[model samples]
Target: MNLFLILFGKIFVFLSSFLNLGSGSTWPGHIALSINKNFLKDTLTKRKFKIILVAGTNGKTTTGKLIKEILETNNNKVFHNEAGANLINGVASSIIKNSTFFGNLNFQYAIYEVDENTLPTLLKFFSSDFIICLNLFRDQLDRYGEVNIILDKWRKAFGKLKAKTTLVLNSDDPQIASLGKKSKAKVLYFGVDEMRKTELEHASDSTYCPNCGSKLLYKRVAFSHLGDWMCESCDNKRPIPNLEKLVSYPLPGLYNRYNTNAAVLVSKSLGINQYFITRVLKKFKPAFGRQEKIYINGKTLQIFLSKNPVSFNQSLMTVKGLKGKNILIALNNKIPDGRDVSWIWDVDFERFIDSFKNIFVSGDRTYDMAVRLKYSFKNSHQKLSVFENYKEALKFGLKKINRKEVLYVLPTYSAMLDLRKILTGKSIL
Candidate 1:
């Protein structure tokens, strides 16, 4: 039965790719799981490879890619689920595709960037060698509820982990760091040690201590709620990280520093030398829609996938650091993007409103985003433009910029995929 499922999944994936229907990242696995509830557990039961599960509100894809690349560079075979396909179906599909006809995975490592809500359920199916929880933020409230909900689920799951499992957590994130306290598994922490702001963003979540429900005090905030935090009531403070500083960072932004640090820590935990890891990281490229650059008709366009409030603010800060003059913001309220678009109001758009010369808005929720921009702009709205048609908006926005000026696009999850499809004439995963 398992063999038949693998063959069926492979055929579906091939046909999906051959016909350009879409990346068969999930459907095949969905069908496989529907047919057999224990598809994942059954297939991966006796696997020889070490499994790594990455879960968080953000940075999963980039960090997973980093680990995969570093391991491959060290001559170790590695495979990861397709980007954006982080659900159970995606996991099953990846297994089916990567495994041989007899359900064997020949890779030394299998890295999976798991969805926040799906982590506990995933753990029930199989035990991972390394479980890395990056950070938790208020994201997709409609889908995942709140940060505390995920924290509860994770803590419960962590309690069940075997001693052989290693947990790599973000020490700066109070919610994530607290998970290490009670877990039976060996825990390692990673955080950034650079200069940080004393202020927190308006949309900062998980500022309260996970131990005693006290408000977390921050000495310095990297961005949002992540930083050097401690609870005054209880003595619960940020754990001293196992790895913090790196010789060089492949990408820009303080958030990327955290992502890079997590990846470096995981690589080190795998017994990969720092010298070899550093060498591999120096040449690493940005994952798709993650500061990914595309050159079209002598113009350069870079995408920063800004889905939630904190992520959106981080993208704005990173683009500002790059001195981006032209900007496009796309907002979508699709199922994948979360039905509610109220989170945009929480983003610190006021900070970067006047920085860009041209700001174009278009998406399913274009008018909603435009309204948010209007409120942010207050008296001066001359720099803003809204187009109902995304293609028209993209064309006009590109034409507005000169050769030397790069167009920076900040988009919600679904909007990012749509914009990338239009620009690159291809679909990723």
Candidate 2:
């Protein structure tokens, strides 16, 4: 019975991709769920495969990629949700594709990049041996409501975890670190030291204590609100993470350092080979569009998926460190992009005006993005160009960036996908 369902779903996935309609990331699993609501629960739970679920708002995809590589380098066969599909259906699809015709799982391990909001429902079907919760922030306000709602959902969901299931979390994020309070499992944490990054963004997501509602104070901020924090009223402070020394990572930005820290902690807690983990950290490649760089015609084009404010700010910092001038930002309001384009205003773009020589804005919501930039770059002296379409924008972007300069592309979710298709003739999703 399960084999027949697998065949049916695989056919739909094939047809979807063949027609060039989409990446077929979710439709197959959606149809499979319609046929058997217990598909994921029945298939996944029946297997002896040890599963590790990576869930959070920002770093899920990148962290999941790192963990997957570590596991594979350690000689474990892993099946992962690659390009951030991340929902329940996507998880189901990843499992289904790795199964034999008789519905037996071929892999020894499954590392799923799960959506933060879907963690409760998805875990109801299957429990992970390890759960890596990176951090939470205000992202896609239309879809997530706010950070607190998901925090409550996770609190309830984590309460159901078994005693043996280890919860690996970022100690800097009070909301993420606090999920283990009710869980009977062993909780492990990872965080940067007190002197990683000091300057804090003016607009941060978590500034108050989750328990006492007192204003949170950061001793040293890594990015946004993630750092060594303490609450004066409740005496809640960032946990001293039970982790070991990690080799330096090649990935850019302080955010990537935090991500590597989280990955190292989870890998250690899982009893993975430390030698392999350290080597993988030193030799890690950019996951998907997370700081991926390409060289074209003696010049370089670096792509950073800055869909939200914190991520955009980090990308801006990365460009600043490299002393880049050619910057192109793409915006889109598609379903995956949260349909709310107002978040662009929340990002700190004014700081880059004096440093940047040329800035190009384009995407589905190009005009709206351009208007947001106009407000910031009005006083600063910088060459700004706007295009309503991506094609014209890419032409201008490629032409403006000289061989001696590096062009940095900052794009939202859908815009990143479209940009990849235009550049490499392939879709990552």
Candidate 3:
């Protein structure tokens, strides 16, 4: 029955791709799971290859790709589900796609970037050799609720982990670091070493103690709630990270630093050499739509997928650091992007809104974003423009920049896929 499901899934995936319907990353697995509840467990129960599950609200895709790059560079075979397919169905589909007709995953490593809500459930199907919980933030509030809700779920999941499993956690994130308290698994932590007095963003989550209800104080903040935090009430504090600073990082932004740290720690835990990991990272190009660069018509465009407030703020900070002049922000309130567009207001646009020379807004909620920008701009808003047509906006934004200048595009989840399809003439997951 499992073999039949795998064969059936492969055909569906092929037709989906052949017909340009979609990536077929989830539906096939959905059908398979519906047909047989234990399809994932049955297929993966005795697999020889190691399994690594990466879970968090942000950085899942990039971190998964980072781990895959490091492992594959060391000559270890690695496969991961297409980006945005972090759900159970997607995991099953990846298995089906990678498996033989008789159901075999012929790879040394399978890195699965799991959805925040899906991790607990995914663990029920199979026990991972390594589980990396990046950081928890308030994201897709309608879908995942608050950070504490996820923390509760994660604590339960971590409790189920065996001693053989290695759990990599972010020490800067209080909610994440606290998960290590009672877990039976071997816990390794990764964090940033830079410490200074930085104010928390207005929309920061997990500012309170996980142990006590008292507010957590920060000696310094990395961005949101993550940093050197301690609860004076309960005497709970940030864990001393097993790995903190890296000699080099592939991408910009402190968030990417955190992502890199998580990936490097996981690599080291897997017995990958530090020298090899550093070499691989220096040559690492970003995953698609994640500071991914593309050139056309003597013009350059770099995409920074900013789906939520925290991610948006970080992207803006990175673009500012790059001295990016042209900016395009595409906001889509689709199901994939979380229908609630109100999150845009939480983004600290006022900090870097005036830095860009030109700003273009488009996508399903063009005016909504335009309004946000209009309110954010402190000076004359002559640089801001809006377009209902995203492709036209891209064309105009590109025209505004020279070959040497990069048009940095910050887009929501679904908007990123649409913009990529427009630029590359094909969909990426």
Candidate 4:
């Protein structure tokens, strides 16, 4: 019966893939497999599989991809959600699609990027051997009520895990790092020691302590609220960094440094050779739209995706040091990208007031972005050009940019995909 069910599941998946339907569309296949788990228990049993789960507000995709690469470099066959389907149904689909007849997962290990809110649900399906908890930030408030809510859920779920599991946590984020204290599993942490780039003294959020009622004290801040912090009353503080040093990348920003550190720690914890980890880190390329570069018609265009205040501020900081003569920005208020659209004010656009040569704004919220730029550069030499249409905006912006000078284009999530379609003549998805 188990063999028959597995064969049926494989056939369904093969047909779905051949039909050009998304791997996520195999939900029915997963349900059928779940029903036969008991019958297939013998084939699935006696298999010691390693599992790595990554969860956070941002950087999940990049970190997950990098960790998968490092694991694969060590000759480990890893099954992962490469298509970015992180929900429960997506995980189920990936498992069913990758398994063979007789309910055997051919892969030696599994690495999944679990969504922050979906971690509790996925935890019930599979017990993770290792978990990487990245920083938490306010994102899509309509969907996720508050950062604290997610943190509380994580704490409750992690408390129920077995003691053998290992957790790799980011100490800089008070919200995320606090979860390690409750987990019965072994915990390893990574963070920056020296204070390089901290947020402004009067930044939003970062108030109230997660442990006790006392206010959290900041020794150094990286951005918004992420930094070396401690609570005086309850004695809550950032966890000690186990992977102290980090390999530097071409990407400019303190946040990228944190990301690199997190990835390095995961690689080391997985028992990967140090030599291979360093080699991969040096050769790592920025994920698409996260400082991705492209060339067209004898001109170089650098694209950076900025969806929220933290990301937008970091992207602006990255280009502030560059001697760019032309700039283009795209903003949108779509569902997946964001709906509030008011978070733009939190970004530090004042730094680019006098640096850019020409600033082009385009997207569904092009006028809103233009007004923000106008206020930022109210007394600067740079002028704002608004185009309601993305294609026209891209044409005009590219025409104004000289081939010798670099054109920096920053767009939100939806706007970035739309701009990529216009620039590359293909869909990024």
Candidate 5:
């Protein structure tokens, strides 16, 4: 019965792609779950696999990809939700497609990037040999309410891991480091030794300590509120760095530094050799749509997925670091890209006025975003154009840049998906 259901879901995936029903991000699992809601949990129980569960506000997908790569580099068979699918249904879709008809696995290891809210429920079903918490910020505020609420859920669900379950943490994030204090399981922390505060976005929810609830004093903020955080009233402080920037990472910004550090330490803790990790870091490209670059006609187009305030600010910082280039920003308020469009106000879009040569905007909320930018611009001469239609915006944005000149695209989740499908003539799904 389970085999038949799994096969059915696999068929749905193929047909969905063939007939263009949007590549089965939801339906295959919906159909499979209708047959067995326990399909994912049930399948995993049959195999005593080594599991790695990664959950956080950002960098979950990239970090999971790195871990999968490192494991495969060492010749380990692994399964993961690599399509940027982190929820229960998404994870189930991956499992159904990857598993044999009998719900058996060919992989020795499973690397999963579970959603922040999904972590609690998934933890009730299966356990992990290692779990990595990248960081926590208030995202989908309508959905999750507060950072502490998600943190409490994580602390509770993750607290139940077996004695051997290794919790890999970001020592720089107080919200992340606090997860280690009460754990009976082995905990490994990784962070940068020091980085000067580049651009501070006060929109971060990490201004207070998770331990004592007192204000956090950041001696240096790497990006957003992630930094060398210290609490005046409590014993909670940023963990001493176990791993720092080893090499000039392939990805941009201080955020990628944290991502690489977490991946390096997690891989090392799993007994993966330093040599393999070094090579992985050297060769790793940005996960697609995450600073993913496309070149055509001597013009480079970069995609930076900006979903939340901190990431949006960091994306701008990424643009600011590059030589002034034409930029296209697309925003949408789909369910996947949080319904609340209010976070746009949180990003310091004003900072980009001096950074880019030309700015083009598109997506569902282009007008709203244009209004936001109008209030944000500091320079009177900055060229800002708005397009409600992405095709025109893509054309206009692409045409503005010439040979060796880059075009940076900053997009919300849905906008990124839609534009990628159109740009590459391939579904980002």
Candidate 6:
């Protein structure tokens, strides 16, 4: 029975591969195979592979990619969902497509970027050898009611894990680090120690104590609510770092420092040697739309996608450093890009008011973005143009930006995809 199931699974993957539908389609096919318990068990049971599960509200994609690179540099074959399909079906599909006729995976490790809400569900079938929890923020209020709800669910789930599993946690994030205390497994924490970059100027999340609901005090803030914090009312505080090393990447903003440090610590814990990690860190480039650069007709345009408050602030900081006179901003309220557009108010848009020649707005909620910008500046001379259509906005914005001056384009997730389709002549989704 197992042999027949394996043969059928292989045939299904072989046919699916011919369609060239890309990595995104693999999850739907994996879901079809997971329905039969014997098929899933028979295939996955034969593999002796290390599993690394990355769960967080943000930075999962970027950090997971970094971890994969570190492992691969050591000649380890890794199987991962490159398209950010992190749900149960997506993970199961990646396993099915990558496994052999006898259900053996032809990879040394499986690194997955999992959604925070689906971590407990995915753990029931797939056990992770190492789990990295970055940080939790209020995101997609329609889908994930609140940050506390996710913390509670993860607390319960980590309590049931095996004692031998290694948990890599971010100490800067109070809510994520709190989960480490609940886990019976060996916990390893990573954090930033630079006081110069710790002070945050704006209102951020994670300001209150997760334990007693009292206002938490921060010794220093890296970005938003992420910092060296301690709760006054309870004994609970940010965990002591097991690995205290500063990462200086070429990327602008302090947020990347946290991400780089987290990746380095996790790679070291997995025994990937510090020498290899240091080499990879120095040469690594930013992922698509996360400060991706492109040239069009002898003109240079930098594209940065800001989905949430923390990311928006970091991207804005990077843009502010560039000597650009022209800037394009795109906003959307799609399901994937986040429906709660109110988070825009939390972003620091005042910093770039006088830096740009003109700001062009596009996306489904372009008018809302325009109003937000209009409210940020007192004078109308800053130049704000609103376009309901993205193509028109891009053309108008690009035409105004000369070849000598750099154009900084910031868009939400869906808008980024739509912009990519227009620029690259291909739909990545």
Give lDDT tens digits, candidate 1, residues 1-429. Answer: 988999999999999989998879999999999999999889777889999999998999999999999999899999888988999999998988898877778999999999999999999999999999998888899997878888999999999999999999999998899997788899999999984699887888889878888888999988888899989999999999999998889998888999999999999888998778988788889998999999988999999999999899999999999999999999999988999999999999999888889999999999999999999985779999999988999999999999998999999999999999899898775
Give Cα distance to truth, residue 117, candidate 1, Å. Answer: 0.5
Highest TM-score: give the candidate number.
1
lDDT of 4 by residue, 1-429 (tens): 655655676677677666756444336435654675343234433556787888887777777777777777888898876444676645655666677765678787777787789888666655688888877777777778887888888899899888878888888877777787767899988887656654433333545677786888887777767778889898888878886566465356776777777887878877789887777777777777878888989988898888777777777777876766678899999886778787788777886656777888999999888888888875953578889999888888889987887788999888988888888887644
TM-score of each: 0.98, 0.95, 0.97, 0.88, 0.95, 0.91
| Residue range 1-429, candidate 6, lDDT tens digits | 555544665576666566755444354435455566544344554568888888887788778878888888888999986555777666666766676766667799888888889898766665678898988876776788888888889898899889868888889888888786767888989887754555665647677787888988888777777888898888778888876566466466566666777788888887888788877877887777777887877777788888887787777777777666777888999888878799888878886677777888889999888888998886774598889998898888878888887778889888998888887787665
The C-alpha lDDT values of all candidates are: 0.91, 0.82, 0.90, 0.75, 0.82, 0.77
**Candidate 1 global CA lDDT score:** 0.91
lDDT of 5 by residue, 301-403 (tens): 8999999988988888877887656888899998988888998899888767666779898999999889888788784635889998999998888888787
Candidates arranged by TM-score, highest first: 1, 3, 2, 5, 6, 4
lDDT of 1 at 157: 95
Assess the local accuracy of residue 301 in candidate 1 as a C-alpha lDDT between 0 and 100: 95
Best by lDDT: 1
How far does residue 51 in candidate 4 sit from its true spot (Å)? 1.7
Q: Give the TM-score of candidate 6.
A: 0.91
Local error of candidate 2 at 222, Å?
A: 1.2
Candidate 1 TM-score, true structure as reference: 0.98
Model 3 off-target regions past 4 Å? none
Better of 5 and 6 by TM-score: 5
Better of 1 and 2 by lDDT: 1
| lDDT (Cα, tens digit) per residue for candidate 3, span 1-429 | 999999999999899989989879999999999999999789888989999999988899889998998898899998888888889999998988898887788999999999999999988998999999998877888987777888899899889889999999999998899897898999999999875547787868889898887999998998888899999998999989988897778898889989999999989888998878988888998989999998989899999999999999999989999999899999999998999999999999999998889999999999999899999989778999899998899989998888889999999989999999899998777
